[model samples]
Target: MDDTGLLVIVDAANVVGSVPDGWWRDRRGAAERLRDRLAAEGVPGHPGPVEIVLVTEGAARGVESVPGVLLDPAQGSGDDRMVDLVAEAGVFFFFFFFSDRELRRRVTSLGADVTGPRAVRPAGGAWAPRRDG
Candidate 1:
């Protein structure tokens, strides 16, 4: 896909925390799952090509990037890193997925359009098992 489309920055912690699906037990796994989902589904609303960056921190820092999803491990705070990304990519149209009020305000001030975790989370609040049989 072209890199010229919208930039989607996903806050790993925030999005994972949005669903209490025992993610606290395996933060890295949770982040990895999010990365894989982004790789498979892309963003729900934006059907165009998008450069998805999953910002990870704390225990989820080492989650690696896949084909479509890029992992950015924050040195300090994921929110700060996301804000920096928004500021750096000021040219591209941005769609940020996270629910922190302060983070939302910070990114919005930097010209980023913000959405909550629901933007990336599963429709039923929990992931359903894929049935390909």
Candidate 2:
């Protein structure tokens, strides 16, 4: 087990893109919105206390960190960064990753638990809820 508590690293683009929304027009905005929600509600299924890291890249780059969520803005490939994070944490550590197929194998090989966007976003919702005016 990790000397530190659980780590939850979210793939900002993956989660944002997983749900169709006006995010295409404002990628950073969507990422920020997601960050806020994660900071507030957190991703479900965590067995105990945990820390959250939101990895931002490509269109969602430059999103800043909030109180509970640490923003990891990838310099290039977000997948590479996510891999690096898990690698840094020894195998005993428990991590929950929010991503899809491409990096699952690699992440699993490193011994980190992986999950999909559905764990965070609501099921059957085509679009992320827009902020109220």
Candidate 3:
């Protein structure tokens, strides 16, 4: 399959929250790290220069979109935005999220393939913020 034809819509908050990295402290930092890693890795099974749309909300709101990654900040709920993305995706596009049961149901109902946050990264690492003494 043509990987470039694929579109990855990610639930930034859910993905970031998947790991217990103290993301609650510096959500922007965590989201930024996720974005950089995604830019570097381009998702797990997907190929490149892949397309990634990351949806952010709450503390991680206002994350800017860069080349290769589209940072979508939800006006209210990230889950709702994800649903809208799935509803609007083309035939070849797919959806990626962490663990929102309702979201999974919604996206799948739209006939879109879905995967976990691991699709972005293995899970772990300095997802947390570092504080100096």
Candidate 4:
């Protein structure tokens, strides 16, 4: 979308919720941790550069955007906001990180490539670049 690389929109709530590492105790901290992870690791299967938009809502709001990641705080429903982003982007190629089936379907219907939260962070709660030969 920005001519840099794929536009990766991350569902913070879904991604964070994907793991049960006591994140529910600190929602904002969890989102920030995810943001920092993105800033450091980036979208793992995607080799090229990318523009990452981390969408946050509820207690996760007010999270600041880092260098490689931009924060999008949703006023109401985070799912709705993500849908609006895909619709507004038109036919641009996108890589979306989401675990929500309905949200995945909605974005995919708009021609987005949807993947699970593990795409950003594995189920083990760690993110290491895939080394494929």
**Top candidate, metric TM-score:** 1
For model 2, how does the per-residue alpha-carbon lDDT over 59-80 read when each residue is reduced to its tens digit?
7888899998999999989999
Q: Which ten-residue region of model 1 has the weakest summed lDDT?
A: 124-133
* Per-residue C-alpha lDDT of model 3 across residues 46-123, encoded as one tens digit per residue: 664456899999888878887778999999988888888877665656867667888898888888788877667555
Off by over 4 Å in 4: 126-133
Full-model lDDT for every candidate: 0.86, 0.79, 0.78, 0.86
Model 1 local distance difference test score: 0.86
- The better candidate by TM-score, 1 or 4, is 1
TM-score of each: 0.91, 0.85, 0.86, 0.88
Residue 3, model 3: Cα distance from true site in angstroms: 9.6
RMSD of each: 3.4, 2.5, 2.7, 6.1
A best-first ranking of the candidates according to their TM-score comes to: 1, 4, 3, 2
Model 1 CA deviation exceeding 4 Å by range: 1-4, 128-133
How do the residues 2-121 of candidate 4 rate in per-residue lDDT, one tens digit apiece? Answer: 666788899999998887777887788889889999998888878797889999999999899999999999999999999999888775778888778898889888999888888887
Clashes of each: 0, 0, 0, 0
